[model samples]
Target: MVGLNRLSLIATLGAVSAQFQKPLLSQLDDVLLETDKTGDKPLVDTESLQAHISTESLFEHANALYELAKSSEQEFGHPTRVIGSEGHRRTLEYVAAKIDSLGDYYKSSTQAFPAVMGQVFQSRLVLGHSVPESASPMSLTPPTTGKEPVYGNLVLVDNEGCGASDYPDKLKGEIAFIKRGTCPFGTKSDFAGRAGAIAAVVFNSNPDGLSGTLGTPTPYHVPTFGLSGKDAEPIVEKLKAGEVVDSIAFIDSVVNTINTTNIIAQTVEGDQENCVMLGAHSDSVGEGPGINDDGSGSLTLLEVATHLTKFSVKNCVRFAWWAGEEEGLLGSDYYVASLPEEENKKIRLFMDYDMMGSPNFAYQVYNATNVANPTGSEQLRNLYVDWYESKGLNYTFIPFDGRSDYDAFIRNGIPGGGIATGAEGIKTEEEEAMFGGKAGDWYDPCYHQLCDDVGNVNATAWLVNTQLVAHSVATFAASFEGFPERETTKAAGVYEKDTLYHGRYLVR
Candidate 1:
C-alpha cells in the first residue's frame, strides 16, 4: 500500500515536470510529500500548484463564478445609489459583504459621493399650428412650467438670406420657424432667444440625419427642442403660406442629485510591496441591470481575487469595483487623480476589465502600435499576447481609443491594457466570419440602455474570456520585468500618444 501511494506521488511529480519548467511546482511537491510522510496535510505551494492547474479547470471555475454573479444580479435587482435618493447604497453593502465572506483578503473603503448631475435647460417653442406629436421633450432636456404657454406665429428665419437680426420683432408672440443650415444649432438657438422668440425649431436639411447635443449646457430662458427633418417640412410649408400660428412652450425639469460610489478591496498580506491593480465599473446607466455590460468583468475580478488569495502571490493585488462609469468615467477618474505620487508610481500596470464576456465578442488588445513609440509600452502588450497565445486562445490587437477606465491610467502615464467585448457598433461581414457573430448587428444592443440584463450576454463567450483574463493576470503577476524609472513631466501632453506608444514621458 505504501509503495503504491509513493508511485502515485511520483507520477504526479513527473507530470508537473513535463508540463512546466518553473521551479515553484517542484518545491510544492516536496512540501506535499513531506506532509504525507508526517501523516499530515501539507501546505500548498502556490507557485508550483498554479503551474499544475490546467487552463480548462481554471476556466470551468471562472464560468461557475460568472453564473453565480449573474444570479446575484437577478436576486439583488438594480442597485442604485444608497445614501442618495437613488437607492444604490444597498448594492455597495451587498458587494462589500460578498468580499468579506471570501475572508480576510478584502478591504472596503467608503468614499463621499461627488455632486454631479445632468444640466437642466429650459426650452420654449411656439408654433403656427398645434403639432403636439411633432414636438416631444428631448431625452436629456428638463420640462418647463410658466404663467402661460408663450405663444407666437411660426416665421421662417433664414440666417444666410436674411441678416442675423431678422427675427423675433417680425413675429413676436409667434413661433420663429427656421431652416436648419449655415449656422451652428446653438448659435441659431441663441439668436432666436435674443429676438424674444418663444422657441426655435431647427430641422435637418440633408437626407442622412442630424443628431447632436445643443453644445454644452445652455441656459436659454425659453424652452427649445430639436425637430426631425421629416417632421418639420409640413410646418415650415404652412408658415410660408403667410398664416398666423401660435404655440406655447415651457421646460422646467430639475436634473440634480444623481449619486454613485466606488468599491475598493485590498488583499490580506501587508508585506507585499509591489502591486497589481485590476478594475471594472459596477454601475450601469439607467437603462438595464448591466449584468453583462460590466457584471461579467466585475465578477471575473472577484473570482480572480478569490482564487489568488488561496495561492500566495508575491505582490499585492488590489481589486476595484468602480461606480459612475456610465456617468462619464467619473469614479475611476476621481480615484486615480486622488492617489498620492508615490502610490501612483507604484502601480506598475493597470489591467482594466470593462466588458469582457460578450458572446460573439471580438478579442482586442490595447497599447499595441509602434512598439518603439514613447507614449505606449510594447513590453506589457507583448506580455499579454504571449500569455494568451501560450494558452492557445485567439486575440486581436485594438488601438487605445480613450473609451474606458484605462483612460485615467494612460492619462497619468501608467502602462494600461484591457479586454472588451464589442458594444453599439456593428461587426462587419468579414469580422463576423472571423468571430462568428451576426453581421450588421451591434456587439451589445442594450449598451447604456434599459435592456442590458442577464439575457443580453453570451454565456459561453463570457466563460472563455473570464478564464483568459485570469490566466493573463496570474502570468503577469508572477514574472513581469520592471521598467527603469523616468523623470516625471508636467506638460498636458497626450500620454497615450507620447508615453504609452513611444515610452517617452510620465505625467507628474
Candidate 2:
C-alpha cells in the first residue's frame, strides 16, 4: 500500500499508457529510466523503505495468518500450519497471493520436495504394575501399533547412555532406562536399539514434564518415551536395590513422506550474480498457531517484501518462506542441497529471521563464532552490532549452534546472520534490565504451546526487530559494498552432524 499510488502514477504516465494505451504496472527498468531522466531517487533508500514498516502493517499480516490457522483447525485437526496439514497448505497460498499482488516488480516461484512427517496417536508407559507420573512419546519414535506392548525387564543404562559402553550385555531383550543429558534422545534410542533392547525410556534431567524429539526417523531408533525425573527417581531407586522392575512401553504413531513447497521470490531488477537472501520458516509446530515462535518472523518478511516492491535495488533481493523447519530444518536443507554450484555461488549472504516477538524479549543477533561460520560472517555480525549501537538499543549475541534456517547456509560456507527476540531460553537479570521483562521467566512462556496465539507476541519487540530487518534488508539490497566473498572451503563443526533442532530443543 505504501507505493501503490506511485506505481499507478508510473503506469498512467509511462509507455504503458501513452504508447500501448494500457494500465500495466511499470517495470523496474522503466522506473530506473524515469529516475535517471528526472534525477529522482533511484536506488532504494533505507529510510524511505524502512518508513513503510509499522506495527500496524506487521500485525495485520500476523492476524491474517492466525485467523487462517484458527479457521483451518476443524479440517486440519489442530490450530497449526504443520508441514503436511491443510493449515500449512492454506498458509502457502496466502503467501503466494501476497506475492502475486505485487504485480511484476518481482518474480516468484516455488520448490516442492518430499519430506518425512510423523504423528503420535498414543503413547503409554507403565512401570511395574502402575503408570508413571507422566509419559510423552519422543518425536519420530517408532510405534508399537500391531505388535504387543513391549514387555521386558528394565535395564538401567550407565552414564546417560551417550556411548556404546553405557549399554551392557544385560540390556539385550530388555527396555533401556536412561537419563537425558550430554547427548540427544535420538542417540540414546539408537544406542538402545543397537544393544538389542526392545525399547527405550529417557527421563528428563529436571523435575518438569518432558517433551522431546528423536531428531529424525532412523532405522536404528527404537520406540522411545520421555518421563518426568520425579517419577523415574522411585524406579531408579528400586532398580538400584536389585528389585526386578517389569515395564511396558507402547506408542502408536505414523511416519510418512509428504510433499511440501517452499515459496521463493526475487527482484527482477538488480545484480543477480550477487544476490542477498532472507528467509523464515512458514510452517509451525503442530501445537498452536505459532504466532510468535515464527509467525512474527514470517510476517516480518512478508511486510518487508510488501514494502520492498515500492523501490528499485542495486543487488537482487531474494525472499524464501521455508516449509517443514520444525522437522529438523527439512525445507531449508532441501533448498540448499538442490541448488546448483553456480546458482549457489550467486548468493552473497543469507540472513535468517526465526523468532522476533518473544513475550519476554531480548534483542539477539547471531554471532557467527562457530567453526562452521565462513569468513564474512563476522562482518555480518558487526553490521547488526553497529545498527543496534546506532539506535542506542541493547543487544546480545547467540551462538551459531546449527539451529534455525541459517544452518544450511552457514554449512555451505555462506556468511549468514539475523535477529531474534528469544525462545525457550530464560531471561537473565542483565537482559531483564535492558529489555524490561521478568528476570527469571522464559523468553516465551507460550513457546510451542496452544496459548501461542495472536496475543502471545510482544508488540514493542516485534516492531523493533522488524525495523532491524528493514534496515539490514534495504541496506544490502542497495549495495554489498565490503561484504565478504563466498568461501569454497567447506567447514563442519564437530557437533553439527548430530545436532537437530526441534523448536530450539537440541535433539542430538
Candidate 3:
C-alpha cells in the first residue's frame, strides 16, 4: 500500500511538473543530437570513447562527490558515504541523476538490501596526561566505553605483535602497545587479550592515523584502538626507556542492521545477453569522505558512462556503484548472489576500479595470469598489460586476493580484472625508480583516514587510470573478439586471502 501510494504521489507530481517542463522523452532527441559527433549515431569505438574522457570532467565530478561527503557530516553527522548513511544516499542520487540525464539511453535502478554495520561513535586514547587526537577504534573490535575505561600501565609489545611471544609477561593486567604490521588487527587484539592485557593500542607504521579493522568479531579480541605514528612515538619511547606510561582506552561502538542501496545502470541499445560490467564501491569507511579510495573509481565510471551515451555498442555495458564494500564487500557479494544463473551468464567480464589516484601511485594491473585465476581472466588481464605496454608506461601486477569488488565475480566463475594505483602497501626502492614516488612511504598515506579528502588524490595518476578504464569499456563493448568463455561451474581457483582487509594492509 505504501509503495502504491508513493507511485501515485510520483504520478501526481509528474503531472503537475509536466505543465511547466518538456517531457523527458521529448528532450532526449535533442540530447541525442547534441551527443552525436556525426549527423548519425556511430558505432561505439575505443578511440571515440577514450576521446571523451577529460581531466576537467573527471575532477568536476570528483569535486562534487567530495563536497557531498563533506556536507554529509554537517547535515547528517556522518562524515562519509558509508552505506545507509545520508552521504551514501546523496551519492546514489548523484549517480542516478547522471543516468537520468541520459534520458532512455540507459536503464537504471537501486538494489536495496540490509547489512550489519559496526559504527564507532567515539574512540579515545589517553597516554598519561596527553590525549592523542588521531586515536580511533578499530572496527569490529571489542568496545570498552560505557563500562569503566580500561586503565593500566602500557607494555610495549616486541616486534609487530603477530605472535604470543611478542606480548611480554609484563603485559598481564596492562595495556599492550604494538605497532600495526604483520598479520591482521584481530591477531594482535587476540594475542593481547590472551596475554591478559586489558586493552590493545595499535599504532601505524606510517604517519597517518590508522583506520582499520579486526577483520571480524572474535571472542578472543579485547578493546582495541589505533594511533598515528607521531602520536605513538613519545609513548613508545617512554615505554622502551622502562618508564611506566599510564593509559586509558575507550571505545563506544555498536553493530546494527541498516538498509542500503546499490546504483546500477546499463545501456538499452546493446545485446544484453553479452554484457560487459564495470564496478566500484560507492560506500566509504566511517572515518572520512572516501573521495579517492573509490570516489575516483566511481566517478571514472560515471564519466565513461556519460561519454558512452554518444555511441552504440555491440555488447551491453553496465556500470555499478556498489554499497557496503568497506564492511566486507557486502554490496557486490549480495549483487552476485542474488543474480539469476541465466542473467549471470550474460556478463562477459567484470572490471573493478578502486583507489586510482593514490598519492604514491603505481600502474598495477590484476595478476590474472596466475594459476589461481578463473578461465577468461588472463585475457582480460592482457588487455590492461597490452594497453600499458602500447603506451610505453611502467606497470606491475597486483594479486587477485579477494580485496575489492571483483571478489564476488571470480568466485562465481565469472572472469574479472581491473587496476589499482596502490593502497596501504609501502613503496619499494624499485617502485620508486619506476613510478617516481618516495620509497618506504605508503602509496596512499591517507588510506582510510580523515585525510583522504580532495587534496589526497594525485590528479595525473587518476586521469591516466580513468582513460585506461574508458579504453577497456570501449574495447569490450565494441567486441569480445579474443575473450574466452566462462565455464558452467564455479571457477577453480585459490583466492589468496591477503592481510589487506578493506584499505588496511597488514605485514603478514
Candidate 4:
C-alpha cells in the first residue's frame, strides 16, 4: 500500500489537473462522432440502438426496475441467509420473479446453504427502550428480556484498543462507546461482553453513517446498536460530565430462512466452446433499496445482455445476478466453487459490477498482479478514466481490495475487474473541491440503509458508469484471446507428488 503522504501528494496534483477540463458529455459526443466517421455504427440509429441499448438506456431501465422494487412493500425486507429470516426468502422470490419475467433471455441457477454470516446487535433487557422510528435491532442480535436500567461512563475504544486480554476488564460495568474501525462490530461486542460491559454503542467513524456487514457473528454476549454520530454526541458529552445516563433497548427482530434467486441470462450467437462471464449481485442489505449498491450494475448488464442477443457476437455472454452478496458474497462463491474444474476453466473473464451510480464516487481500477491483465480490463479502466478526465469528471483511483464478488475469481487466478462508486467515507477537501460533494460528507450516506431507496440514485452518474461497463463488455466479447488450458490429470499428479514429499519430510 502507498503511504498517506504519497497518496495525498498525488491526489493534490491530480486534483489541480482535473479542474481544467471539458465536460464529459461533450467528450463522449466527440468520441462517438470520431468512431462514427471511422465507419463505426452511429450512436443514434434506431435499428442499431434497438439491437443494443446504449449505456444511458440501460441506466434508465435500471432506474425503472429500482422504482418497481422500491414501490413494492412486498419486496421490502428480502433478507437472505444473514439472519436466516423470512426476508431472505422474499428477496429470493423477488429476484426469481424478475428473471422469470425476462422470458427466455435468462437461465436460473442456485447454490444451496452457502456459508453466510453478519454482525449482531441485541437490546439490553433492562435497557429495553422504545424502538427508534428509523432504527431496528441489527440482524443476529441476541434476544433479551431483562429491563434493568443500566448506567455507566462511555469509553471510546479506537482501533488499537481491542483484543488485549486485560482490555475487557478495564471497561467492566461501563458503557463502551467504540469507533467503527479495524475489526468487525462482532469483535468489539465480543470484547465488551467478555469484559463485563453492560451495553455497547457504535458510531460511524466517518461523516457517512456506518453501513455494510461486519462479516461474522460475535460469539460473546452483549446488547448492541449502531448510532449515527449525531445521536452519539450528546451521550459522549454526558459521559465527560460524569452524568449517570439511563436508557431502554427494545430488540424484537427475528431470523428465519428465505428464498432468493440468481438470474443468469445468455447470448449464444457464437461458438459455446468458451464463455465470457459478467456478473453482479442483485440483492441489497435490508437497510435500503440498494438502487446503487448493485441496481446500477445489474441494470447496465441487463440492458447489455438484452441487446447483445440481438446481434451476431462470436462468443457467449452470460449475465449472472447473484443473491446473498451482502452476507459475504454467498451466491457467487457458491456458484463458482460448485462448478466442475472443467467447467470452471471455461470462463474467460468474470466482470463484476457492485456499485456504479454514486455521482461522488471516484472511478477506480483493480490492480491485479501475477495473472496477466486480460484483453479489455486495463483498457476499460483507462478508457473510463480518460473519458472522465476529458469530460472533466472529478474522479480518483482506489487501490484494489477484494471486498466484492471479484474475490472468487482472483482466488482462482481468473482474470477479472469492475467499477464502483464511493461508499461510507467522506471525500477530502481536495476531492470535494474537484468533485461536488461536501468535504466532510460521504459520497452516499444512505448506503446499506433504508434511505438507499430508488430516489437516492444519481441518474447522470449511473448513465456514464453503465455506459463504460457496457462498452468494455462489448469490446471484450468482440476480441478476447483464449485462456491457457491446464491438463487436469497431469496437474493432479503434480499436486499429489508435492503433497507426498511434504508429508514424508516436512511433517516428520
Best by lDDT: 2
Judging by TM-score, tell me the better candidate of 2 and 3. 2
Q: Between candidates 1 and 4, which one is better according to TM-score? A: 1
Q: Locate the minimum summed-lDDT window of 10 residues in model 1.
A: 499-508
Cα RMSD (angstroms) for every candidate in the order listed? 9.3, 6.6, 11.0, 15.7
Show pairs that collide, candidate 2.
184-508
Spell out the clash pairs found in candidate 3: 182-507
The models' CA-based lDDT, in order, is 0.58, 0.83, 0.82, 0.56
Cα lDDT tens digits for candidate 3, 381-486: 9999999999889999988777898988877778888999998889999999999999999999999887888888898899888889989998988888878875
Off by over 4 Å in 1: 1-87, 118-141, 145-253, 268-273, 367-378, 391-393, 397-399, 482-508
Candidate 4 worst ten-residue window by lDDT: 499-508
Candidate 4, superposed: residue stretches over 4 Å from native:
1-51, 54-67, 70-139, 145-214, 218-252, 269-273, 359-361, 367-394, 432-440, 449-451, 482-508
Ranking by TM-score: 2, 3, 1, 4
What tens digits encode model 4's per-residue C-alpha lDDT throughout 451-485?
Answer: 66556677766766666666666655554554333
* lDDT per residue as tens, model 2, 403-498: 799888877777788888888888999999998999999999999888888899999989888888888889999888888677663543422444
lDDT preference between candidates 1 and 2, better one: 2
- Sorted on lDDT, highest at the top, how do the candidates line up? 2, 3, 1, 4
Per-residue lDDT tens digits for candidate 1, residues 204-238, read 66433343333323555234566666777767677
Best by TM-score: 2
TM-score of each: 0.65, 0.85, 0.73, 0.61
